[model samples]
Target: MRLAIVLYPGFADWECALLMAAARTHLGVEIDVATADGATVTSMGGLDVSPHLSIDALDPAGFDGLVICGGTVWDTAEAPDLSGTIRTFDRDKRLVAAICGGVNALATCGLLDRVEHTGNNAASLAALHGYRGQTHYREQPQALRSGHVITAAGTAPISFAGEILRGLGLGSEELDGFLALYGREHVAATSAG
Candidate 1:
């Protein structure tokens, strides 16, 4: 499967990294990183990522799934055009996943109105007031899945990617093997903690 991950000027790096790792390891999926512009995308932590495709150059039909990473970019009142792009992908039946404040983009495009989802925090949940399927995943600690939409809380990129892998029908054993092969200490830490 082909996955398209959208990047922006201020996206979260860990979110992108974890999802890309999941796509590569569990499903052996081809991941194409795209940006609103062809320019290098930078994260809030000053990390720079080069996208494989520009938003204007992307074909919504080419991807089996699309994930939008959240960060400071979504906190603004001015809506981004990327929301429309995500909406187009959703209309095409591509699996759409949003992480953290990325839900803001989905909300702005009206995609979250009746779709189940979760966000960064209580304020983030409040922001998605018009959304009908909103739920808090305190016990599980991550908004893993809600129908076709997969939403995750802030900084939970690893779990978010795992949920996506599960949604794509990749077994947990495969994900565990991948994590082991990749020397991902975070999983170990999570398990131990």
Candidate 2:
């Protein structure tokens, strides 16, 4: 499976690093970086990435999903309105995932209005003009997948990754174990033979 990770200036790079590593290492998912203008974007951590694919250039047919990394730009007044690209992916039945401030984009696009989604909190979303999905908002520390959309708080990348895998039909016992190891203090269950 192939996934496109959308990045922006001042993005939270660490949020998706473990997810990308684990998914690619375990599931063999091909992950690519995409930016707003097919140029380089610097993360909040000062990591620079030069992406070849522009957000407008992504073809939903060619990629299985779009994972948007949270960035401060998303919370600014001049946030990128990703409605068109996001809707295109959703229209084609492809996975649409976002976390932290990235969730604001989904809120701006009104996808969260139709599905149960979680982010940093519901109060923050209420500030957005396009957000009318308050009733559908779920307050949780983990990532949630409703229909084909996945949303998460910034602190829940491990959970977000697991949900992404689950959304991609890659959920399994091993996957659970994989996430458990990363998410918490895992306790292994033993079977009596």
Candidate 3:
């Protein structure tokens, strides 16, 4: 499977690290990092990311899913307008996942208005997010998947990645193992002790 992961200046590296690593190394999925201008950008944690393509250049038909990573940039006045790209992905029924501030992108595109979704918090984002999806919001600590759309808080990368893997058709057994390993590493250590 191929996934187009969106990135930008101040992108939250922690929010998507596990998802990308696990998806690539364990699931063998192909990932293409996209930026607003197809150039290298620095993450909030100071990591530099060189994107493979520009978000504006991507064709939804060429990929199986889209991943929009969280970042403070999404809350700013100059957030990249990814509405067209997100709409195309949704129209084609491809998996569309967004986390934390990335949820603002989907909300602004009106994709969350009909689907159950969660993010950092609804109240804090309501003013910045003028979208009408409030009634469907679920205040969960993990990621929530509705139909082809998946949304999560910034702190739940494990659940976020798990849902993405599950949506990509990974078997339950494999998912269980993945979650077991990542979701509860301390359990394994304690059990071994």
Q: How many residue pairs clash in each candidate?
A: 0, 0, 0
Candidate 3 matches the true fold with a TM-score of 0.93
C-alpha lDDT of residue 13 in model 3: 88
Best by lDDT: 2
Candidate 1, clashing residue pairs? none
Give a tens-digit lDDT track for model 2, residues 1-193.
9999999999998778887898788789998899988999999989999886899889999999999999899878779989999999999999999999999999998888889999999999999988999999999988999978999999998999989989999999998987887755444677899
Clashes of 1: 0
TM-score of each: 0.80, 0.93, 0.93
lDDT for predicted candidate 3 compared with the true structure: 0.89
Error of 2 at 26 (Å): 2.1
How many clashing pairs in candidate 3?
A: 0
Tell me which residue pairs clash in candidate 2: none
Q: Which rank order by TM-score, best down to worst? A: 2, 3, 1
The candidate 1 region of ten consecutive residues with least summed lDDT is: 131-140
Give me candidate 1's TM-score against the actual structure: 0.80
Residue 118 displacement (Å), model 3: 0.6
Tens-digit lDDT track of model 3 for 63-122: 989999999798788887788999999999999999999999999889988999999998
